[model samples]
Target: MVQHIRLVGIEASDKQALGYTELAHGIPHIEGEFGDVLRRSHAELIGLCAFIFRRQTPLTTEWLRQADNLLDRKLDELQRLPASHPLDQTGVILPGGNRSSYPLRWAELLGEILHPLLYRYRSELLQAPIEPYFGSYR
Candidate 1:
């Protein structure tokens, strides 16, 4: 599973600086690696969104619709599984024998952080003309 890192405000600034700092600090080619990490983090969020709303007929925002479309296209490339894939096996064994699948566990973990992150950064996240924000990712 990919670990998602949140880069809000000052943290984002710090990461940007760290990505560009010279190699004398012992880190090599950090900017490209940082960009890749950021992209994977964003993809995780997009996947969580896709998993949560896969059954919904329509999403409330255009950005969400676009994300869903992207996820759909990406998923289509994979071959169908006749049975549950190994990653789909139960991962979280809760108390009293309750269990959650790997994907569900991932979604739950992401939801815990993402909901609050979105709320805390609502002004920036919910600004008008959201399509451009999604487009920038492309």
Candidate 2:
């Protein structure tokens, strides 16, 4: 079964979308139907966000749990099956699960520290006219 994860964020304005190109020339626009690679990146980003945000405050524990389960399940599924799973067939690259373990930990730690700081330091100018801060993890 294919499960889709929703990315929680406001849409970018036409102007806002332009900045994405400076870095993500290879990444297609984060809209419409995507191929496998883009979808996989989106899923990873969503999981990372859930892990980081659930650390404190009104934590979304259920979402985090589901993400964790999905991570584990996907890893196992990928190992037992071929890379030709429908999701995999589309362009979604499976993060080679083991090789990336440490980076994910580092991201969690950084998120724990930074997410709060971002909220604290945000100004009317900084906070207003703000785009959803998808950190540079493309």
Candidate 3:
């Protein structure tokens, strides 16, 4: 929702998306395939949020800002990775405590980094039939 202008109450049209616009300010654009991936996944997640909203769940901009703060910080760190002359590698772990290699998105990387922090909210938000936003992380 950081990359969008509206969050709710807007009708989708050929010229307009449900709650999106070109005017994104929360996270500055990262160029190249990384930027494309961020934009696409953001669209997907916002669509997912809309689905949740339709199901009577509310997503707040303040929460979005919090999320954006983390993302901005991470991306800023990542951007500095190429400049800081530090050697940090990313290794993906497998299902059974093994390790594997897979090329993926930084947004997903953000999710991985933030998921634990977000899980702390489940106790406050989860009830009845709604599952936690994310199940136990792998």
Q: Quick one: best lDDT, which candidate?
A: 3
Runs of candidate 3 exceeding 4 Å displacement: 1-51, 54-59, 80-126, 130-138
Model 1: lDDT to the true structure: 0.31
| Candidates by TM-score, descending order | 3, 2, 1
Model 2: per-residue Cα lDDT over 1-138, one tens digit each: 112223332232211111111112223333454433444433122222322232323224433554576557556544665443334433454566322221122223333333233223222001122224667755
- Model 3 sits at a Cα RMSD from the real structure of 15.6
Q: What would the TM-scores of all predictions be? A: 0.22, 0.24, 0.25
Over the stretch 53-134, how does candidate 1's per-residue lDDT look in tens digits? 2222222243355546644654533334221444343454545464533333323334333333332222232111112222
Question: What are the lDDT figures for the candidates, one per model?
Answer: 0.31, 0.31, 0.34
What's the CA RMSD of model 1 in angstroms? 15.4
Clashing pairs in 1: none
Model 1 residue runs over 4 Å out of place are 1-59, 79-86, 89-121, 124-138
Give the per-residue lDDT of model 3 (tens digit) for 1-138: 222323333333211223221122212235677555544443223222122222222333334566676657667555654322111234445455644333334334434332232222222221112223434443
**Which ranges in model 2 have alpha carbons more than 4 Å from their true place?**
1-54, 80-89, 92-128, 132-138
